[model samples]
Target chain A: MIVVGLLALILAFDVAHAGEIVALPNEEPSLVLQEPNECLQGNSYCAVRTSERRKFKWIEKSATLTMDWQTLLLRLEPGVFRLISGNLWVSPQKGQSEILTVETEAAQFSSRYEFWIRREESQILILSVRGPVEIRLRGDSQVYVLESGFQNWISRVDRRGRAQMGIPRAIDIESHIEVWARLFPGSRTEFRAALEEWRPIWLNAVGLSSEIHQELVHHRELAMAREHRSKKAQAEARASENQRLRELFRQKVLLE
Target chain B: MTRFVLFILCLTLALIEVRSYFHNYFSQSDRLRGEVGKLKERLARETLRRDLMAHQLDDFRQVVATLLPEALKPQRSNRADDYPLRNLATIVFEQKSLNLGLERAGVLFSKAKTHFQQGEYERSNRIFSSLIQNYPDTVHLAESYFLLAEGQFQAGDFEGSVRNLDAMITLFPESSLTGYGMLRLGKIFESQDRFEDAEVVYRTISKMFKDESMLVQEAQSRLKAVEL
Candidate 1:
């Protein structure tokens, strides 16, 4: 009995120390891994690291990483990343999470979400690839949970120099899936697998799909209406400008 | 004797009429020949002029090929007096050395752009910096500065990028890339949480580039975001 207990203790200790090493699903050409120390020294092209504190800055291109049990603090440039697992804290600038705070949880949790974070020119975009994600503006009490096929654009700066949380906007299923395929590589089968494995389950999540679909349709319609209005206004302004210019030219001709 | 005399007179009249007709026809033919000769001369002159223009265009294309070889490829219109050729002529006529300098700069810029596309930011930054330092008077000065700023921004050198962008704006206000530079500056400011500065830059872009519809729209969208 004593021997069995000792063996069990050793096994538990080993399990505790052993970190998860998730497979990096990358094709041969795109998989460039920097040396461990090089990554720590602030090389942007370095692979994602967790043993030491590192800042991963992506510029122009997109990268995807599969994490184990490690937690990473990502300092992003204008780029995109598709995180497979583990936890991530993303901020545009170093030590400035106040603008945007995005935290991802593992799939085991009831509210776990798998998502893609894109740092665009003016905003930080979060797209839920598989599950829902919890997003909050720094210093704000409100936590916005975004479901799959939904996106949010967090503005880096508002009029008051503070970051603002955007409303949850629904993205089309095809676009969401396209983003997944582009970032994660491989065929549709892999994407389906990832989605199936990480799909979130909220309490009383029934009939949520139709509601989300309706919201998406409504958002699309609103966007279309705004675009139409903008085009009409622009056309009217152009016409008025042309009329003014023509009048000025006519007056000059009359004076001549 | 009377009949013979009348026939002889008639024959003489007919011969005279035929002679006048022949004379008029020969004179008309001579004028037509003269016209044909003049036309042939004019055609030769035009063909020679076209050949000279084609040769000059080929030389200008060779210079452009040093920078971007793809630009020299045949395209629609194929006008000999295209903008690049015109610019080349002006530069070459002003100073032959300047044209040579532009060619060198183009080569360097192409290499730097390739590096940038390949994700080699450090090398790209270095080459772009060298091009700016060495070829300040090159036609690509404004674009090179912008690209250098982009490389610096990607390398996490925000301050350097801002300085380069400011320099580009100040030095090349008339450049086509000025609007894009202003837009990028606003984006950087937004990234740094400088809302007022970002708004100012976006507003400036909107005001300055009223004719650039796409750029104006982008600026307007960014302005709305800043307000929100």
Candidate 2:
């Protein structure tokens, strides 16, 4: 749930930043995260907002992470990312020896392999999809190691004003098939190919058979078509914005 | 008496004819011997030319062997299945080797440098590799190796960067760029948080070069930071 505050509108500058937009049909234009500048330092904090499109992207360079939307990210340290809301599916780049760190409202999640974290209602649900993940709850020094196919939850004491924590428990990974499809959606064929890299994890754990493989392909056409439409619209919007800027400049500067 | 004189003249004439025949045969034999000697010389020259051509062919084969891998090996399909229609949108190539231009090695080197400067590290590495593979004896070989390593580092290919840096240093120890290459290697070590390894590299660079005063100063400055 993205809250399009008045501050976002006020702080959103008219500068020509690439691939950024603030829009929705029923609500006010909700573009809050000011980004692409902070990530340039290579060792400092970088902030990014998930686009209003259907692209499940692996943010490249140092801290490469895969994600599905519904996120408002603010302040990312070298290894740590603070997810305000929505689910974040992160995996360290293949062969990279570094660990990835993600912080929620209550617990800090760190892992060398693939994991997912989502904030729902008053709790933060974390699912370790691939390897072991270390979860350190806020104000508690005890680090809980959650293995693969296990899920845990923590209370958002700061945000929701509720404190709840849960032990690691086994989860049905087959149930999360739709979730992975939605997140890494390009096509079933494509998704299956991408999953080859995580062969040891997904193939054995999920047991994705031919039937599930077919179901994954259903969302391909629609998502791609939607992505094309939105991207084209974004390009047009950027062009129109540029044109408007030129017109304003001509009227204001040249006329004056 | 007259009959005896005629018999004597006939005998002399016959003897003279025999002598002429023998002289003609001897002269012909000498001419044939001279021709055989000349033929032998021509044969020797042809054999030497053939041997030289064979040597040149061997050298050419050696040159091709360095560059043939890129041309022969198919590009890895990292995202071939990711987008089914991706081939229509992008260049799809397999089975065929990329263009090899040993003659245009200089032009390719400059292009690689431009790519590196523009921060297109992957593209830069590809071009540099082509140049290195095709033109092993290229004038820009040392720099190409250095830039290739540097580009790999930028592209987060730490292992490749290390291997390339080691190769460049080993191959071109006499080149002026070796000090800089070592310095970059030190930086790569530091990037991987191998602080002790980086300190050792810096120390080696500081100690190894007498004329490379600039590199020595840089290494010394870096040493202080790494020490801290």
Candidate 3:
């Protein structure tokens, strides 16, 4: 169970960073084990508060773990963030609830919203949302749902050169009804078209399906093989030519 | 019985270690979580401060634009011409609290001149035009017109250049640049093949400066070559 949880955390880290998953070199990343506690199976949640480098606090309750920590550091300013996983929901300090979801081939969780928080007095409150999961804030507490489809799926290019991938999560915003209705009429269509343009490049990079992509890979391989053979033949021909010239010179010398 | 005894002893040791580890781990994790929380707060405050500074800088630029003159006079810098004119304007841009009008005009003039040197003719022309429109009372009005003429020339708008040069010569007759302006007029007339009109301008320059400035000599040479 510990090993499985560690793997999931590593995968989550990969999604947050631009998909580089190797561990940092020459240093053992410190891992602190917490006592086993009941994990939230439904509507899992976590929150953190950071105060520029002086102190930090985290409270996490998920389908697999219930962990909380508070620590002090020299200073912390930019690039501090909070991440939570499992069928999650978020409630911001102000307007509509949100849900976030994460899906993978092995396991799937929906409505897993992540948020950052800042400390006020002794308590912390949400400041911003980072992941595509839904969020609900105060006043007009409608639940907004936004989730990423391909949060994690390690892909290796196959011999046939194709890979399947999912799309990023959608975002939900609620404004005055008139404004909202006016803005959303063609929003989905435009967004899908934009996604379609980027889909092929990403899919090929991850080794996914497409006849054109496969044909390109085949041509590249064939060209490489031909180049190798041509180079070898040129070397052999040069050797033969050199030997023949040497023999002819030897005969000419003997005749003289 | 012996195997069971050994197993019990191992279990005891494991329990002892596990309890102590969990106790220490939970305490340390709590401390770490608190630190991360504080860092987030600091980040928010710092970001807010930086954003406010940027907003203030933008506002300063707008105020400078509003107060600068319609025509800008160029100042020959004590610093070598190799230094960009815009750098001279930096002090004025940073002094927005002063509400001084002429200083801002100087900055705009410097910016226009820098743009012209960089081959951004359109931008330079617009800056010069703005100076002329905004600060007609400015002493640099005639200079602005002249600079605009130079911009038009660089952009292949010879007709526009002729109009602006004519305006500069008429508006600032007593201005120190009359000789230079007249010389430009001669060159323009020569380009149009109006050799007789060009000769009159060259003769006028010769009468104005008996010392015969280098520009007068060039104009005289061009006139003679045209006559031949």
As a TM-score, model 3 comes out at 0.27
User: Who wins the TM-score comparison?
Assistant: 2
TM-score of chain B of each: 0.56, 0.54, 0.53
What i-RMS does each candidate reach, in Å?
A: 45.1, 48.2, 30.3
Off by over 4 Å in 3: A1-256, B1-99
CAPRI-style class, candidate 1: incorrect
Give the lowest summed-lDDT range of ten residues in model 1 chain A. A102-111
Give candidate 2's TM-score: 0.32
> Each candidate's DockQ score against the native complex?
0.01, 0.00, 0.01
Ranking by lDDT: 2, 1, 3
Runs of candidate 2 exceeding 4 Å displacement: A1-42, A56-63, A158-163, A185-187, A193-256, B1-228
* Residue B64 displacement (Å), model 3: 30
| Model 1, CA-based lDDT | 0.57
For residues A1-256, what per-residue lDDT tens digits would candidate 3 score against the true structure?
Answer: 5445545665565357544333323123122211111111222321222222222122223311111233211111121222221111222222332332222211222343333222224222221233344333212134443332212222212212222222222122221122222222247677467446534544443343245357778998999999999999978975674455334322322232
- Of the true interface contacts, each candidate retains a share of 0.00, 0.00, 0.00
What shift in Å separates residue B74 of candidate 1 from its native position after superposition?
34
lDDT (Cα, tens digit) per residue for candidate 3, span B50-157: 544563464354334433321112354455662544553454345442456776887897788678667798999999989988877665576678667767866878
lDDT of 1 by residue, A31-90 (tens): 222323235346353234332232233322123233322223332322323232233322
